[model samples]
Target: MTSAQISPRTTAEPTSLTTRSLAPDLARGAMLLLIALANIPWYLWGAEQRDLSQHPVDGSTLDRAVQTVMLIAVDARSYPMFAALFGYGIWQLYSRQAAAGTPHREARALLRRRHWWMVAFGGVHALLLWAGDIVGAYGLVGLVLVALFIDRADRTLRTWAIVLTSVLLAAGVLALISAALLAAAGADLGASGQVGVDTGVAEPSYLASVLDRVVTWAVGAPAQAFLTGTIPTAVLVGILAARHRLLEEPERHLPLLRRTAVVGIAVGWLGGAVTAAQHLDLWGIPAALDWGFLFLQTSTGLLGGLGYVALFGLLAARLRRRERGPGRVAWALQAVGKRSLTSYLAQSVLMAPLLAAWGFGLGAELSSATAALVAVGVWLLTVGLACWLESAGRRGPAERALRRLAYRR
Candidate 1:
């Protein structure tokens, strides 16, 4: 172990677009849509909030339908997928450094710096636009996980992942059983008014709203990353997947991808459907059991998120078989994925003004269906921006900035 071996002459450079894998990018590009859908609902400030629900209590049939579908497919599912991908990206970065002859300690320090910058980015994002920002949460988790587990053996990663997942499952089960028992005992556990934080989206004052958003972000980021158990668990599994180059070489793991896609999506959707039923009052579920349903949905969300990742991996494999390569739509989506951070922040940029009460306050005037249309439009706009950047051979501004900060000697 010579000093030269311990410290490479130069650190690894950022990955070039040409060398980037298709599956991860494609998955990211597509999931931004889901993230849009999930976040936009919080902007509907004029609508009546329900206990244990992100959706408003009132809407048209179409709005209800949209809400149902979103609950079943989007809500808790998208972030975990992003978390998995984030973890995978971390591993990719760390490995690239190792391959470039950087020592483990130095490489870890580089990643720590990057993650800290991400936290800063998220804080600014939350303060300026959306309070429900995920960047900080993922960054926070990345910092801890990289320091603790980045050098751990494969078996250790797997063991910890399993332990975390089991804990989530057990928590879900206990919540359900306790709720049922309380309901049977005739405990008055009905709707206890609206749940969730007031993130100043509905506030008429911009300065006041800024305070609200920052406060919400400060509390929610840590709670989401650590307390929920979903993000951390998914992140661990993502590290394991990256270790095997699952996304990078999807063709080599067809059977596993296919099985995970099928089973994971099925279970995730089933859990979400049950929660949706309760939300819609279609199942006549006791209000006492609201937390139970919520727990079930969150617990199963990790699988749903991973299922989406596997599905995209398979899609990437199919694209590889094409003679002309991916079509225009695939290329466009990949562009957005390549510039994902910019595209993601761009959603807040586009929507906050039009929808927030401090701005034009369109959220007060929109229903679920309309809000969804707005989200999709915002996403499409980002797609176009990403495509333009791709054509110009320029990285997204956010990406370029982060790279400069992270790679600074």
Candidate 2:
């Protein structure tokens, strides 16, 4: 093969761990930490009232304080960042496949195989370890979008991204407005929908926790697919960003990045704060009725998430100009990012036994701040392990298996 033909293929294949960017990997690594923090609450089932929510309504002052902080910045913020990264990563997959001169039909078939496996993995993860599994939804929506838009033009990609995102956001804005009208009319909306386990278990039992997970997973899977449009919209944005060379070449798009960071973050923080206030009873709203707040985040989170992407891109540009490559921290994060699938699953493995009622039974005992500290410890464990694996020149077990499945023999 000519050098020209070989060069692109050599760099495009991410499965080989070549041609990776620091910022994307860093973003993924940071994203995992945040996801850990967000997801830990799902495991908390106490020996008390056995009620589950994002946080205990009757938590100590510190727990309430932690809940407010999380609601404003960390809770809804992390999902979109993770979703955007997932979308961006898939684009890398498709592009590399094309660059390798694989035929359209074959490439698509391979994509299908990878995602279906992902679906299987996600299904297992949700049922066994955690019910808030997003991997399955990403894979499901990914399969649909890849088939629909892989061959579409940049113009069409942008249009669809805008439209889908707009639809999701509009729904949120409408809901918020309606809720305001209801409040004005003194209508009692009442507590609706399950925020957490909500199993009504008075004391923790292994069997009860298992039952909770099964029921929640069964319910969450369908809600994840249809409720928010979070997956497909993020995927579309990733496609558009990839086509425009947004994250890959950030310095050239300074104005765009600046605008996105400022506007998206401002809107996101505002909406999130409103939700947090209401949830904390600062706004005198029932904490159980978080659907309104969920809508607020759902509407604005895409912007916040994309803004984070842009902000990270700008940071990457600075890092590139300053040094030859990343430092020790970046290297550690990249290691986890590179093996994101495995690192993510490892958290569940580590935490399920530590936090679950079926294991250490720490869930009922710890407060919000303490639980978050535990979450950080869990993430740090993975980061340390990822660094060791990187030093040993090893791929994550899940990543290796996934490549074998996706690439076939």
Models 1 onward score TM values of 0.96, 0.90
By lDDT, the best candidate is 1
Candidate 2 segments whose C-alpha is farther than 4 A from its true place = 1-14, 47-53, 190-212, 286-289
Q: What is the C-alpha lDDT of each candidate?
A: 0.89, 0.74
Backbone clash numbers for all candidates listed: 0, 0
Clashes of 1: 0
Q: Candidate 1, TM-score vs. the true structure?
A: 0.96
C-alpha displacement of 333 in model 1, angstroms? Answer: 1.0
Evaluate model 1: give its lDDT.
Answer: 0.89
Give Cα distance to truth, residue 78, candidate 1, Å: 0.1
Best by TM-score: 1
**Model 2 over residues 37-114: C-alpha lDDT tens digits?**
887766566523211237656677888788777766677677788777777877777787788776666666777878
